[model samples]
Target: MGIYGFDLLIAGLCLLFKQITQLSYVFSFILLFLSGSVIPFENLPEIVRKIGLMLPLTQGVLLGKKIVFEDLSMSAATGSSDFLWLVISSLVYLTLGVLGYKKCEKIAKEKGILSHY
Candidate 1:
């Protein structure tokens, strides 16, 4: 779900932004770097950690870590509030991404920028 939302959001951005390629490429790398994949989230500043957890992918990654190291089952995690927040956040991103894509698609088509892109 995190992957789906993140991909949709980026795809929507590619259609909406003028600097499509660079925005998608550079932003993805930055997202990955801040996702706590390379750095333990515990090592980050409190504010940074909080912000990262708000993003879908970062929360999913942390959930996966909990499952692996804490011996938590997928079913058990579903019962936890943290896991619920992760799902809700992913759904929020999904909704925004889909809406942004539809709106941008209409604008791009009218402006004749769809094919130019």
Candidate 2:
């Protein structure tokens, strides 16, 4: 759900800022690295790890680890602050994505570029 929100946000941004499509690869690369897909979270530098902890993907990854490797039940694994963060972040991102897309859609319609975009 959080990842879907993030993708929706990016899609809306691309409609408003076409140039972003070109830079999205770089953005994805950075996101993957920060989310600990490329390296273990603990091995990351202190500052990077701190920043990563705030990202939605990081929360998902950590939660998944706890449920899988740690054999924790879903309720037990998600009972902590991490789950709260994930829910909050997901809602925030999803709301922002919908609002932004609506705004951009209006602008695109006004400019007569909605179809092309």
Candidate 3:
């Protein structure tokens, strides 16, 4: 799941940037907020909470919280609907990341600038 998110992050950066410097700060903040790491998910505004729920990392964060605070067994936690959602989101990110990377490669090849950015 983490690998899927990391792949998506890398592919997104490749698609969006000609140079990657200074982009980490923005990505970090967005990831932190959307993943519910910076604040409790219940504390977020309604709309923001809804948005965060749709993101890939939110379920993982929630599962971790449950495991720690509620002492949920790994098997029990993974059997929940949240785990299903996490799997679905992982597949979505994996697909998007592969497509984005392919697109970026095509563009770079066409531009004849295949050297490292």
Best by lDDT: 2
Per-residue alpha-carbon lDDT of candidate 1 for residues 6-111, written as tens digits (9 for 90 to 100): 6666776666676767777877876676678878888888888877887888888888999999999989998998798888998898887777777778887887
- Per-residue C-alpha lDDT of model 2 across residues 51-101, encoded as one tens digit per residue: 888778888888888888888898876788878988988777677778777
TM-score of 1: 0.85
Q: Could you tell me how far off, in angstroms, the CA of residue 32 lies in candidate 1 after the best superposition?
A: 1.7
Listed in order, each prediction's TM-score against the native is 0.85, 0.83, 0.85
Best of the two (1, 3) by TM-score: 1
lDDT of 2 at 5: 66
Report the error of model 2 at residue 34, Å.
1.0
Better of 1 and 3 by lDDT: 1
Q: Candidate 1 — what's its lDDT?
A: 0.79
Scored by lDDT, model 3 comes in at: 0.76
Candidate with the larger TM-score of 1 and 2: 1
Give the range where candidate 3 is weakest over 10 consecutive residues by summed lDDT: 2-11
Ranking by lDDT: 2, 1, 3
lDDT: worst 10-residue window of model 1: 1-10
Model 3 bad stretches (over 4 Å):
2-12
